[model samples]
Target: MSEVNISELNDSQVIGWLNRGGLKASADGEIGLWNEAESALGALSAAQVRTGVSSGNSLQLQARDVDGTSWTSFLTLTAGNTPTCAIDRTVIGATTPAAATFTTINGKTPSAFGLSLWDAADAAAARSTLGVNKHYMSLSQSSGSAIGDGDTRYVTEAILTTAEGYATRLYPMHTGTITRVIVQTSCQAVNGSNETATVYLRKNASSDTTLSSSVQFNSARQVYDVTGLNVSVSSGDYFTFKVAFPTYATNPTGVLMRIDVEITY
Candidate 1:
């Protein structure tokens, strides 16, 4: 909706950027004035990039649809340990762009990921080592298609101790890192019984990577956050979850899965 240029940075932001660069002008003659100008932008450095969330920095660029209800497209550069950058121009049903919209202009300084043409790389690959390759990551364990990787699931199978099947699958719409996976079921096993269902993240039916420890079914409402997982999946990868259940006296009804991902598109 609103956007301010990077030239309008405040005093604090300038000072922070200078401090981060360790820029100290050397001149004994001008020490009197130089000391006062410690907050000067003397170096090519920026300490903090505005965390563009609800509100924070002065330099921000945000775009919304006409109704301003759904976020049609927004390219917000968020600052954190994972200094993520996201740029989305998904105007699916539009014939032409509206006013103040960024157009695909040519005839400018072209950019390759590497310094030399021999050293080739993509945009996401270039920023991976800096830990900023991640674009946007979000999730809600609750049901809905509004979140980043929608957790809306429909597993309509009755699982008994005798049968275990591929109860979950994920078709990533974007390429990113899956940071977390939460699985909550309608049951948990008793202390003595071995009513356990081990879940795995299987891709293309090749190697089976265990998502979490064995999920035992006995209690009414048992939730398990899958551990030992930091899966990096592409948009084309077919990811299916294999649930293998051990012998049990009491069978479970269904399984609910939620995946929190850092999507870079």
Candidate 2:
């Protein structure tokens, strides 16, 4: 019928065209089908038809033909080398630090029972006393209280006041040798009399007494100090200091008084 080259034949047609589905070639030298012995045919492989199921290009691997223990060598194909992408180099900063804020209030109340200094209505000018040692003191009256060794009570009505003068008790209750003293005072004034006061260090109604200091004032608030005055106060002892206006001086400018006394041993 028609003459056709075997190489140009379709795959299915070539298979059927061969007698017994095989070919007769000269030797296993070129790319031609060979028909040696059945064992020799086993060394040759059929051409594999691979189909790609995904959208990517197809990839092929090197294959060999094997006999009992030997194989036909295969040539390497340099076709599919995957390409690499570049990476960017950079230094990114971290998040900023948070700011600080205040959380609570810190405050304190004023000291009520310590040495106090205030002006009186009778003094011609301000008076200050320094270094007057304290022995012991307390506010036992219904209206006032005192601060003493080993005593820790802070309350109002621990101080006494009047137009003429004020009174509180003191005792030297300490552990070591008694050294110096501090005194605080406040007073109410009466008319025409210069604001005057007498601070005392005494044991009782009939005992040893010392006039450590005094003050004179002409107004509502005043402060006075008696310093370097030799007076003694110790631990676990009682002493009293009375702030009084000179009596028999008729209608002296009277005022309420406050006293803060401190002693060191």
Candidate 3:
């Protein structure tokens, strides 16, 4: 029969064969084992359980659900970052780290007024190159005359093409409407007299009917705000200004400055 000294053994070993399985101590003394029945019974023991770290710079957080179930992380470990760093939606903004492009309008010579069109050459600054559009038109001075009667009819409108002008850039608005017309002229007559000049808007280079008319080029810069006129302009519809020399004998020679027509939607 095997014998155990009571002083050197525990209650579990003493009553092992007599009662339900009891506690036992291992040789290493690191672990104390108990029987399944005794462990399930009124066993209330104190243990140094790890609740959280104290004064630790790094902390490990376990993801859990509302039901207290642990969950796995979805993201992979990245190469260049600190483990403690975090990214949240609250710190995010509307934009991203991608390149953005914008649209613009440009001006060219020969166009009576400033002309603009869509170009793809990335020509924004003065040094950048610009891609010219073939369909557009360009306007420039056609002829020069001495100071004569205040005859705006002497002004002419020709086809504005890329090859003939300094820059092949001009666009006509077919469906758009003519918002305004401005005519600049130099009355070289010695008297510097206020003269009445007739302005005309012709369709297709035919100086027949004036779509719109102005009476005087009193100053060097004559402007006619046609927004109230409500004139409809189409693609093929182009215009020219005419100067009527009422006092031709007094002012024999007259000079034409510029005629500008603006069409907008």
Q: Pick the candidate with the highest lDDT.
A: 1
Q: In candidate 2, what are the lDDT values of residues 68-146, reduced to their tens digit?
A: 4543323211222442222221221343334323232244332332122222222222222233332433333333222
> How does each model score on TM-score?
0.35, 0.32, 0.34
Could you give candidate 3's per-residue lDDT for residues 36-119 as a string of tens digits?
A: 554311121254211112222221222344475764342222223333333322222453334323332333333322222222
Error of 2 at 129 (Å): 24
- Cα displacement (Å) at residue 215, model 2: 2.5
Candidate 2 residue spans exceeding 4 A from truth: 1-167, 171-173, 176-182, 187-192, 204-209, 212-214, 247-254
Kindly provide the TM-score of model 2 when superposed on the true structure, using C-alpha atoms: 0.32
Q: What is candidate 1's lDDT per residue for 1-265, written digit by digit as tens?
A: 2343335533333212332332232232111111244532223224443332332212224455668675454555544555655645545356434433222235444344323322325555556644665544322223211111112122223222222234444567667656556665543222324456666666655767776656654555566775546677786775655555555454343333334434444
* Best-matching candidate per TM-score: 1
* Global lDDT scores for all candidate models: 0.44, 0.36, 0.40
What is the lDDT for 77 in model 2? 19
